[model samples]
Target: MEKNELGMTHKKKEFSEWYPELLIRSEFIDYSLVSGAIVFRPSAYFAWEIIKDYVDKEFKKIGIENVYFPLFIPESLLLKEAEHFEGFSPEVAWVTHAGKSELSERLAVRPTSETIMYYSYAKWIRSWRDLPLRYNQWNNVVRWEFKNPTPFIRTREFLWNEGHSVFASEQEARAERDQILGIYLKALRELTCLYGIVGKKTDYEKFAGAVESYSIELVMPDGWCVQGPDFHYDGQNFSKAFDIKFINKESKEEYAYQNTYAISTRVLGVMVATHSDDKGLVLPPKLAQKQVVIVPIPARSEDIDKKLQDYSEKVLNTLKEHGLRAFIDNRDNYTPGYKFNEWELKGVPFRLEIGKKELESNTVVIAIRDTSEKKGVSLDKLIEAIDNEIEAMHNRLYENSKRMVQSFIHNIESYDELKKNIANGGIYHAPWCGSTDCEIKIKQETGAKITNIPLDQSDLHGRCIYCNKEARYMANFARSY
Candidate 1:
């Protein structure tokens, strides 16, 4: 098909415009009639499935089980936790009427399932035997955002997997929280080849009801940061709110410590923005729906076609036997060059091109999507080359991203420096005296917000950027999405 023209600008000129257009072009997602919502087409949904399957397997290995919860939470239950409710009320979507009749108590589409899930936990856990309830849900949530929404990034509704857990003590809860964060970090690195800064979000940036929160922030190609995954230590926040209590081995009753964490499809958007080029998406091989695409070049006589088809089957079986996601693009109408670009846009990791000449030589030509590297490999050593290419591509993606991340951070020791950095558009690292007034002052002056208070707390020798008071902590300040 000739390239369809839509309302999108060229990819090279405007990345922001290109993103939405490419999504539609790739059959990933599309806009819906409702404002701030989009429909996930097969391609995007399949990618999400790949991520979910791998992540779910990892969670299961760590003793977490999948579970589903109700979509509508009682207004009373959502409001039970006053602080949580206050934090969420501004963005909550309420259902006041059921069909034709108005209900006495309004219901809420879950902004998050913590309140509703914990209410059930309170009923289920009566003793220490039920101390650690490790459950996760693959579901969607709604939040009414006033700002303009980007697909996957800040939509009113989106898909995400939320993990909630309860433990007998603070120590166990904290450990689990960090453990989950570690898993998320590893998954991002392994599957997407994306690196991130692992640190704690500042009080203002922390999750609404969390006592403490940590996040992995992946840097996109344009130097903007995207939150990869997040972990929250609920502490007694949810337990006290929901009265989730249990009896100890000695028969004494106590509140259970808790934690909740989530990774969303927004992460897929981050990956696409980070790795994809003007041509199209350059998906990491591990996460690609189809890692290796085999295209037979040059039409041959029926007798030759039969022989080549037999050989192609052997190659496909070999790659599959080695556990690679491989596919054969057997359509006869398109030229080999057309198939090459199509697969490149789709970000298939390795493309194997075979023809009579190469078949006679007992070899195939391999092209990599990431680096556009090409080489000829003997059929016997194809699997080995494929393995090497995947590793090399991941290393390249990580190195390039790490370099871009370094460019986006500016170390600031004074208010003037903060102003300059903010104007230039990047994250500024500055010292703060741990005062709300000073933080607010900096924002009023620079239009920047405190994004993170790193757990690896480092004492700054310099004074606070705003009040010139004794600084306590080094904070990452930025203009966030």
Candidate 2:
């Protein structure tokens, strides 16, 4: 086999090296000319589109309308909310000049759309009838992160849905949290085939200017935690800052309760890291660009070669007619083994081998990507078999993710245990008194910050791990990506 067809140079266990190798070698994504930015190849982009479309459809069902905002926000608008501006200032990229001349007011490449979107919200909203303004935008934002960039994870520029919602009361605003989080969770499970810990953020760890924040936390294969989709209850912070007021039924002006939530390309990174292996990418069947690849293994004889080619096309059409993304590799230069290795590296969920034997028997040998399982299915039963295989592969990946995440969660009773176990990357589930002092000390001493306080607060009986004060909510602490 050629060096290019031999698969990844680094093993999945050597994650630091293996990750980029797999993604690049498999042609999933590529490093861009600009630093901290990446070009998502067809496979990666297709996966994101699947995720984005799924979430968008769900959003529309729940009355969230899609809208687009300008890529740049005026510096004055960003500074309207002091805390929001402060949180993003370090990462914000500025556009001080247009072509050659300096602009009077500098424009910030949007780190988040809260300021820009809310500015319009204040103008559009006027009465109680416009109580709930649930608007979301699918856009790209530039953060210009100083830390070392990871493709899809911590890039300088990334794409996401910035869902900004306005409601009449705090109750209405807070209620939207679960609905949005549920959509994200469903996308992770059904499309990404992954699991996450749904939890509330600590005050110190919450989104800047949010009254309270919630997140879906996912753990990587390396055992480090990375946050997934998140929802924030902003209360009246942005409404007050931007003056998004509405007249109530009693003819009184009141600030709108607000919430913001997002699911980003970062989760795509988590999905890739969690499910992929040394062979190459291991994409879920639903998210694969080409779910099935039919490779015709010709016997060199003219008669057999023609038969294999015709049979492969028939199988491709059959799968496609049944709504499967299928393709045929009938290239003359490459051998069957080479094609198999190449497709496997590219992470096609299923490979159909149609050769002389399959042509004679009217069957194709299906190769499952994730498990490397092979079985021959008759042409008539091929579609059903592929559907079953897709479901099975999705379930297996999801289960694996669930099991791995569960294993990383450790219930600790003492601070000593936390300090000892913190080095081995995983979430340390320990008691907290809700003090920033303890949160800071734990991070400083052990390098583990609070990931979140899980919604499931059962068995909340223990002393604070650090200060030994009465425990409040149980928090998950981990060294994150």
Candidate 3:
């Protein structure tokens, strides 16, 4: 009698059940004592570390230096920006007392860091040279979300990086916003093989105090078009509130143009939802903590078991020497069947199965998790084969995810058609006039909101999806998580 990990129920028949069940059973995350937060298990935290390490390097290259800021913001400073404060006030966690004494003013656990950071920026920046202040912070933010908490998605507190920058001119500020967003988009593809559509948020849906905002929308297994990561163009919004002004080249004191963006742990959720299947998790090699796992198959005879272990050790060393993250499963108590199921459930990008037939043939079986394809490779060429297989697996995951995301998109031409298909999940691309009232009506009629307005929009001369008014842009509509 052994306590083995549990496999998830059928994902297709019961996705909501399957999703959270696998996350907990796989030891990725656990529901914490805290009502709305989670303790990331070692397995899940390591994956997040891999992403942070890569992104941290990227930020350094672009001259965006990292620094830490106090987690609590005084109520007075938080309310300096009325819109930003109002938007997050409901969810803000306030500290009104210290031990037993009442505090003079409440301090808010930061829902976002704009107000606090900009207040310091005002004192730090004195002239034109200080104009391009590019600073980044990797920290936790508290929002006290009330909705059902999902691991790595909706939580009261989450790990996220907020990159704030200042520029002397409008052009520089705008360009930097787009450039930083490009970095995040690249991070998604290279890190997780997740595909998404980049679009501008409507005025109503844009960041509370941002001049403009954009999001990358992906279709989950349940067909909801959810946003994982997003960026904002602050455009002197916070600078004005906090008086972050500097002397210009022309010797004029002016407010600095600014921008801030946040990419959170929720991205890992998107990767899991998009790529994992009925069998178990299917991880992208780049972010997988243990990229490759080799399981040694013990023979019935003692002599054969000894030979297999020796060979498996050599194979494990070879893979490690090639700069691969790998592990060898040589635990005697577990059967080979148990090992296979265990690694597959963990989503190791590739697995090595070594046995007697392969030893005589001088070959080893390679299992590709993403495609569930197994092949035999010559022992002499094992390193080269694994490298190539890993690359192929990454490409396949990206292509398959891209295809699925494209399949969920339906272009709507009629309001009745929208109502008929609202329940059927997916992103509906439809023409709409730029009107908040029209947008509200659409939400009332259909639960879906206009998530984004695509950057490269189609010609817009038709009637709005709701009001029959002139269509201004092709907006993405979906019921989101």
Per-model TM against the reference: 0.93, 0.98, 0.97
Model 3 misplaced stretches (Cα beyond 4 Å)? 1-5
Q: Order of candidates by lDDT, top first?
A: 2, 3, 1
Best by lDDT: 2
- Sequence-dependent TM-score of model 3: 0.97
Each candidate: what lDDT? 0.82, 0.91, 0.84
Q: How badly does each model clash, as a count of residue pairs?
A: 0, 0, 0
- Residue 323, candidate 2: how far off, in angstroms? 1.1
Q: Number of the top candidate by TM-score?
A: 2
Kindly list the per-residue Cα lDDT of model 1 for residues 1-481, writing each as its tens digit: 5332322245734767878776766566789998889998776777788788878999999999999999999999998888789889999999999789999998999999999999899999899998689999999999999998888888999888999999999999998866788788877888777777778877767788899889887665555566778999989988988899999888999999988999998888877777877767678777777889998876558877776777788899999999999988988877777788787777787899888877788888998887787899999999899999989998887677677677888888888887865755677778888888888777777778777776676556688888889888888787766
**Backbone clashes, candidate 1:** 0
Runs in model 2 with CA error above 4 Å? 1-6
Relative to the true structure, candidate 1 reaches a TM of 0.93
